[model samples]
Target: MSDLSKRRLKLWIRLLGVTRGAENHLRDYLRREHATTLPRFDVMAALWRRRDGVTMSELSRMLLVSNGNATAVVDRLEADGLARREAEDGDRRRIRVRLTPAGLTSFEAMATGHEAEVDAIFDRLSDNDLDTMREILTRAGKAT
Candidate 1:
């Protein structure tokens, strides 16, 4: 293999390692500190972004997860009174899920902690380093 090809392969592995490490850390943090799972946090985050609500299919698409997976999370949220599912007008088959007031308050608190945790995780990276990484990642994404 060419030198550049070998370097690219190494870079990919390094990226995956870093991503997984960070993910694991966040997962543990959420579970230990908030009594919540990462999937629940993700679902809340998506709902937080779209206050109006989103259909099950739309939510699934936005999260890049299967509808069943999204439904399971939503079910838990609804059971906890953190979210509600309402049928769209004249569309009995389409149920839109949204964060309840309690859910919004809960997510706000969680989001603050989540941001702080993420900031701390990346605290070692300088502004310039972040810029460079973003540029490189954007280019790599385009390449794919």
Candidate 2:
């Protein structure tokens, strides 16, 4: 096989394994250090980055979770007092989601801790390799 052909048929399982490893690493860190699940943190992470609170549909799209799944996650966060939902005064049907002050504090702490773990994971790469990897992955994400 030509070099390109070999890459074209490369074992997807290996790629999945690598992806799973990264997921597991983050999940483990979130569980042990933050006492939270990856899904919950992901929801908070999305909201934390938003200058203003986002609508449920926006959160669903940004997080790549189903509307139902996102709703469930939001419900859990609300129950735990980590998130608050406000109905748009003009449009009663539309709701906005934002992290509570407590939630923001929690998200910030988790972010700092998570950054360290992510940096540690990438520390093995040379600077050039890391930059290239970042560029490639960002393009890959946009393609998605």
**Whole-model lDDT values for every prediction:** 0.96, 0.90
Model 1, clash count? 0
Residue lDDT tens for model 1, 15-123: 9999999999999999999999999999999999999999999999999999999999999999999999998996888889999999999999999999999999999
Instruction: Give the poorly placed runs of model 1, Cα more than 4 Å off.
Output: none
**Residues 67-128 of candidate 2: C-alpha lDDT, one tens digit per residue:** 99999999999999989999878787999999998989989999999999888877889989
lDDT of 1: 0.96
Candidate 2: stretches off by over 4 Å: 1-3, 11-13, 138-144
Worst 10 residues of 1 by lDDT: 87-96
